[model samples]
Target chain A: MDLLPFFQQLEATTVGRVVRESLWMFPVIECVHLLALALLGGAVLLVDLRLLGFGLVNQPVDLLARKADPWLLAAWMVIIATGIPMFLSEATKCYYSPPFFYKIGLLVIASVYTFTYRRRVTRELAYGRAPLTACASLALWFGVGFAGRWIAFY
Target chain B: MNFSAFVQWLDATPGSVALRESMLGYPMIETMHVLTLCLFLGMIALVDLRLLGLGFQSIPVSEVAGRLLPIGLAGFVLMAVSGALLFYSGPIRAYGNIFFRIKMALIMLTGINALVFHYTIYKRVASWDRDPIPPLRARLAGLCSLVLWSAVVVCGRMQAYNWFEKAPGA
Candidate 1:
């Protein structure tokens, strides 16, 4: 189904108007969004490194991943909160952007991988290894970031 | 001998020419630069926040720093390589960019702040390594790192926008 109508309605809201009309506000939100993206990407990669048999080896892989999980999740929350207003402000532009869709797709795949197979494998490191999963996780999340950045290029 | 001459030489370099002319090379390098930056910030925030008494209190600051350092260093190394490539791709424009100048200045300030911390209170960190609230200087160092890096990220991000423009010379 077409989503432009929903985007249009959201953009008509007071918050959306402020986000769209105020030059500084959009940039401010953008700054927050970008920082959150970086934090999230970093946190995720740190955990991924553990899965790849590197980084944070002083502690158990599970512990490292668990400890870093909160920051990863917190940054994700901030990104989503800040992102919505920016998206609402330029809903149509984003809706038409290919890279935006790529970002979303990669985000979904990365999150799923994080919550499922990646978590299981890291939890049970004795049962063989999942270096391929680690590699894919890195590519997927970083891909989301790259695609998100690409949205601005267009 | 002069900065302009150096920039001119860089612009004429073969690798730089390919970076600018290739369809995917510049974008791919830019992507890596940004992603590495994100990873670096993430690792920095973990240690800095603990020092600032904000987050991750369960673990000792030293342990947190120890664990994240290698990954952070890797990110920094990769970013340096990608960043040099980016600047080399368009030496004149990068040198002329106001935001690029701010970014460099902030990076220098951050380096100095870290150096001072390492040389001073951080050397005697054993006593307060596990303290929930760090000593005044340690807290100040952490606060400075956060603010300085925040500014650096903003300046770096803004470099791609309108504030950057090409000058006739470097």
Candidate 2:
């Protein structure tokens, strides 16, 4: 299905129009998005670092993950919430933007892998695969962040 | 030389001109700068949160600081290098930006806060390192760091909008 038509329609919605029309609105939302990104990035970094045997050496992987969980969840919630309006305001542009697609693709994979595979591996204390998992996790998440930034330039 | 003249001279340098004019240079540096924030601010926030007794209550404060400090320091190095490149790319613009001024002030304040905490309260970590709730001074330091760093981020982000620039032909 050609999703361009749907995206165009979505951009016509009231929320989209408001966000797009107001000069300050988009920037304000972007600031919030970035703040949440810091928190989420921090949470992800700590867990991934621990798994890689870098820092937090004495703390158990599962315990550190558990401690960082609330922050991760809260930050993700804010990021998604802020991200939606940003997408809506420029849905059609995003549809045409390759970086937008790349960002979304990376975001989905990162989220799934983080919660499922990474979580299980940490819980199981799979030391052998921990480094690889940590590397993959960082690459995927940072890939998302990079592509997200590229959307503007694209 | 005066500060403004220095900024103007720096902005006019060949390297700065190339960075600003290059299709990839500015954006790449900017992307690196933004990406590293997660690492830099993230670690700092964790330590700050612990100091404030907000999170990671089970771990001793010293361990939290010791282990994470290295990572945070590494992130800080990246942040600083990329940040300097960004400033080098457009010194005049940054020098004039109100948000940039605020960000600089906040960063300096954060540095002072960290130094004070380390020398005064943090020197006695053995006394309160085991306590989930740190001493009042330590907690105050954490609170200040959180607030100042957050403001720094806000100002840093806002610097991009050109909100303070005079409207053309006004």
Candidate 3:
């Protein structure tokens, strides 16, 4: 079995070459990645904390969710854009790395959790039911963050 | 005079020696540090961006802040643990590193800024609660936060290049 196909594909791409070879590219892209992460982190903190009944006790849950949605979307967009290129530049390394794989998996789970939290959980909680999804949402995102950090090592 | 000596003594401690000698210790600690950083910064930015009107427009500032607190705190916890481990592994070197020093200073500033936001402006803002534009203080805090945190990240990245070098005079 050819284990290096992804690496071969990466080697063939001009952008991949630049990402790997350019002195400034990694730092610049990493900066963008961090910025995007900040945006995502901030937005999630607001909504998730509310679900846990910490902040904005007076405000309706749905209203809070609506307010924070845009920033989350923008942050995710930036993350995807910057993250994909970084991933592509070192596909082989990333693919073989367990932490990288876990990060990607957690990210997908987080995205799904975000949607579910909004649609099913937030709406139910707005009517005065206790938020059941808050704990899970928090855990998923934390996993994403933890796994993301581990990627550097793995 | 005493402070410098104390720093030197701490660096020479057995715990520090053990930390450096552990096989996977350094890499694991570094990885955890970066992860916590991402978590801490990520959560803060999400909340802050909301305050700045990036997302969740219909949500109350208080509500948004409330929801993100636990995860943020958890991130902080992880950071503290991992960060201490990092310092332990290279006490003398990190202590003398300019980038590391700067990063620590900025982290303190960020914490202070956060406390101020939570205690004062946040209360007032929540009362008004739906202002089209964030209050002057809130906006200022937000801007300061973004700059300080970004500075922390830059300093962190620069740490690898800023370790102590032998002085010619010494």
Candidate that would win on lDDT? 2
Could you tell me the lDDT of residue B165 within candidate 3? 58
Measured by TM-score, how close is model 2 to the native structure? Answer: 0.97
Q: Compared with the true structure, what per-residue lDDT tens digits does model 2 show for residues B108-157?
A: 99999999998999899998988989989999999999889888888988
* TM-scores of chain B, in order: 0.92, 0.97, 0.87
- Give the winner by TM-score: 2
lDDT accuracy of residue B127 in candidate 2: 88
Q: Give the Cα error of residue A15 in candidate 1, in Å.
A: 4.0
How far off is residue A63 in model 1, in Å?
3.5
Q: How far is each candidate from the true structure, as Cα RMSD in Å?
A: 3.6, 1.4, 4.2
DockQ of each: 0.59, 0.86, 0.34
Q: Write model 3 residue lDDT over B97-160, tens digit each, in one string.
A: 8888899999999989988987888878756467645777887777778789889887777676
Instruction: Give every collision pair in model 1.
Output: none
Candidates, ranked, TM-score: 2, 1, 3
lDDT of 1 by residue, A3-29 (tens): 889878887888888888985788778
CAPRI quality level assigned to candidate 3 from its DockQ score: acceptable
User: Which runs in model 1 stand beyond 4 Å of their true positions?
Assistant: A4-17, A112-133, B12-18, B163-170
